[model samples]
Target chain A: MKTKKSLLFISYEEARHICDKIQYGEATRMEQIKLFIRISWCNISRKYTQKNTQLTTLCQSANLKSLDKDKKDSLKKMLESKMSESKD
Target chain B: MSSNTLDPTQWIDKYADYLYNYSVSRVSDNEIAQDLVQETFLAALKSSENYKGDASERTWLISILKRKIIDYYRKINSKKGKAEVRMSYNSDGDGDGDWMEERISDPHGNNAEEKIQNTELGLAIHECISKLPPKQAKIFSMKTIEGYETETICNELDITPSNLWVIIHRARTALTACLEENWF
Candidate 1:
């Protein structure tokens, strides 16, 4: 009778081989699944990152537009003050 | 946008095959694997400014792909109404009869060697891998199958070294058990 340890060792070796077969394309279904997951992941991340950049850009533009509006308001106030002082 | 400016398409042409092979090795599905690779390239191109060269371009792409895989599984399992179960073998328990019997039966049988030699072994492995819990399978495939160094795997997976080792050990043990039950 084989010891439990020996049996475990054999099983592990077999498992590694099984894993290798899948890795090397010896199994079609497994290969397909692997590919599918990878492709899906790549696509999802790509879209996610793209959206992130767009969002950032939008936020930056909004900030810039607000800043510009503030600048224009300040200029108008300065001109009004000078006109009032000259009229007085 | 210049005519000669390296674009996503050019990068795809250069790295698609490699990325495809790499993704296939992990997820084992052709269309999905290709999609992942394509997406990686697209993401890289869109976020090119974020590329700090801290990692190789390929490595950065793979890291993104890995995150995508995790998200996919999370979405899948959640949809199926199955709560993810995390199990660990204590390695000190009295060997369970079912586990021992499983080891003996070698469900894939002695013919496993022949199966391993067959080209379809890749597919079989992929199927088995898919059956694995998402994290375990990812770590196992990335480390053992993809031949990534442990440190790199840790970085890509965003896990600490100790956590990485623990996960790998659990993954290998689980895979071993799985093979015994299914592939023999």
Candidate 2:
């Protein structure tokens, strides 16, 4: 009884977190298997996993890019100076 | 009911990715896009008084950025012997963004049609991301859009791996729900 309960004990939040890790290619094989088992029985987990994968695929296709930290830092400094100059 | 506020200190942190994506879609040049984002911030600061708290700051910044992009083209047009044809897009016209986008070739293995669609889809994704709570938006952009390593994000944000994962999960839930109406 204890073993069975332990096997099925994963919370939905935990399962969803694992889903996120899997999407990012960060989940370990053991973690992957745990998620696989959870999704096998939990309809909510399965649905979330599907939507999560679809979201990743869509973002991947979108080819989004981020402004790096160095540029962002420079922009911030520029804005600071401009703000001060405007006030003066 | 409109209740939005502007905070310049938070601008770079919150809206930089959003504006970067916005400008990249229009300009199609990475360095130029980053410069435009910077200019957008400076311009917004100069005209900060014009913001009446009605529109969200992101919307207002985007509006300003749109004008700046147009001006960028005008500047280039005059520099190139003033004979360069200025391309304009009819937002509602059937021909698509005929003038500008039709000219720039995408080097990222995307054909023109796919590039245009991806731009729209990218903007839509950013729009949904912009609606997330600030931390979640930042985390999602860094991890997913920026493609930062998990450890790097954890170190920068001072979050544990599990904390980041929780935030990612919540952000994904919101993003998926948001995107489902227009995309799936």
Best by lDDT: 2
> Candidate 1, which CAPRI tier?
incorrect
The candidates' DockQ values read 0.01, 0.76
Q: What is the Cα-based lDDT of residue A73 in candidate 2? A: 90
Error of 2 at B95 (Å): 28
Segments of candidate 2 deviating more than 4 angstroms: A1-9, B82-110, B181-184
Q: Residue B95, candidate 1: how far off, in angstroms?
A: 18
Worst 10 residues of 2 chain B by lDDT: B96-105
lDDT of 1 by residue, B22-92 (tens): 56655757666655655565555556667666675556766777776677667777887866677565555
Best by TM-score: 2
* TM-score result, candidate 1: 0.32
The CAPRI classification for model 2 reads as medium
